[model samples]
Target: MRLHEYEAEEIFSKYGINVPQGGLAKTTQEAVQIATNIGVPVVLKSQVLVGGRGKAGGVKIIDNLNDVERVVAEILKSEIKGFKPEGVLVLKKIEIKKEIYLGITIERTSGIPIIMLCSEGGVDIEEVAHRNPEKIFKLSVDTLQNLYSFQIINMVKKIGLTGKTLIGVVNTVFKLYQVFKKYDGLIAEINPLVITENHEIFCVDAVLEVDDSALFRHPELNKRKLNNMSERDKRLMEKGATFVKLDGNIGIICSGAGLAMTTMDLIKDYPSLAPANFLETGGGITSELMFDCMELVLEQPGLKAVLINLYGGINPIHEGAKGIAKIIREKKVNIPIVAKALGNRQEETWKTLEEAGVYVIKESETQKAVKFLSELLGVKK
Candidate 1:
């Protein structure tokens, strides 16, 4: 789950990563008090889960003590991209000599955590990647081994840091890696990891995102509510399924997470076609489960079609097909439904789905099936 900057900075402080003095305030009075305690020339940052807080005017700087209350009140009243601020982070502003980017995240294809560092920072890394991909340097971490200081030094040296600065940067990066490993973090980032005028390093902006699936292991971190979880998400969680709603027209159901993601990516490949949701029914599929999954998918509004990508590795494809067909018949679903069911009892599954008027594809390539779904939605490209 994504963490507010205040919360992320708190975690960073515990790991010996330097961060500007800050406190979280939910009220204007509290914000004023924190600002007074920390002294003036403070930055008032809106504690919103979404990004673009600066562009949305959710962030403001107050140099005068009298302006703290007014700025805090203004920020508290504002929302960033439809997400209201939960609180305001009052931090003492520091002078920056240089800004660098440091981040660690699990790479999808390799399933290995990769550390990304760039000399250009204080902005979205994605923008930098697209505009100047060569500026970013990546190092894949072997989860089984410790992240050595030498490895971090080698990567950062190429960015042209040496002497005391190199030592400090290496130490900070190593500590950040420790924090990433200890918290089961999906993403731990320190944007604009700054070098102050005094030549001291500090994490000016922090972002820590713990893996939701691994939250059970960290009781303290797990206490925070899973932000923005819908009733549909809660229901799916209770039923041993994973579902992520998206803004699109195709409802996707797959037997595996990889397949579900692959299907979503392929649908996105076509112009004007996107997957409406990611629904993965992990092992032990049955007709009843299939029927329930279909009902859930159909409940979503603005869905123009449904795509089912299932593999019968250890699942009963024929039996699951019965449940899907049963639900479509009962609900009288008119939107196009396509199923690419492959594996054991494939022909039987095909017969059941086709008889229920659901288009069936017996091919191994999911792109072909996705193209067919795009055609049904009048978005084939």
Candidate 2:
């Protein structure tokens, strides 16, 4: 699960990573009070999970008193990518002489934790890497072992650091790694991990995505749902279904992870066709549950089309078809839904979809299905 910047900053401090002084505020008055107490030169950040906050007017620096209340009020009411702010973080803005990026994430294929660092920070590291790969440095780390001093020195050198600055960065990286391992994090990152004119380094921004699978070991996180999940998501989770909303137009429903992922990948490759979510109905889900799942998928924001990619080797297509039919019979769906189901009773399944007026695509013609959906949406790539 992903964490808000404030929550991640709290975790950073707990792991001994220095961060700017700040507190979360839920109201304009609270923000004004906090800013008053902290003095001027504070930054107001939107607590939403989506990116491009700066461009969205979710981030503002208050160097003057007249703009403090106005900026905070604007931010508190702002929406970024269809997500309204829960609140604004009133953080002490730090003076930066330089910005650095440091992050540790698992290498998907290798299953090894890798430390990625770049002196070119403050901006999106992925964009930096895409435009200039040589600027980003990477090393795969064995989390089971302690970081060696030599390894820390190597990172410092690659980022062009020396003296006290090098020592501070080394310590920061060490603590950041500790936070990563302790939380079973998929990503523990500090963007614009800044260096002040005073020569002190502080993590000005943080983004942490924890391993949801490992949350069982961190019971507190499970109990609280990381305080990030919406009530709808929490209820869905209790039903053994997984749904993650994304900024896309196509709502995806499938039985297994691999099929759903592959379908999503194919759709992404197509111009103007993006998967809205990863909604896995799981194996042996009842028709009633499938009905509910589709209902939920239909309600998804920014959804223009639905794609049901099903393989019925173990999850019989007949039963899956029954669920799809249930949705057709009960729900009033305006969006076009296309499905590709195979196994158990292919003929019967195709008949079911045809009867429900659901379009069917051959399992071998996956790319064709994606193309059909893209054209059906009438959107530009």
For TM-score, the strongest prediction is 2
Q: Ten consecutive residues with minimal summed lDDT in candidate 2?
A: 226-235
Q: How does model 2 score by TM-score? A: 0.89
> Can you give the TM-score per candidate against the true fold?
0.74, 0.89
Across 1-381, the per-residue lDDT of candidate 2 in tens digits comes to: 777898899989998888988789999888888888888899999998777889978898889866878888888777787788988999888988999899999998899999999988888887898898998988889767877878978977987898888889989998988889889998999998898877799999999988877889888777766466656566566667777667688899987877788889989886667888888876575566677678778876677789987777766677668878888777767678898887767788889888898889866667777777777776545
RMSD of each: 5.0, 2.7
What candidate 1 gets wrong by more than 4 Å, as runs, is: 226-233, 243-255, 268-365, 368-381
- How displaced is residue 186 in candidate 1, in Å? 2.0
Candidate 2 accuracy as lDDT: 0.83
For each candidate, what is the lDDT? Answer: 0.86, 0.83
Q: Against the true structure, candidate 1 has what lDDT?
A: 0.86
Least accurate stretch of 10 residues (summed lDDT) in model 1? 225-234
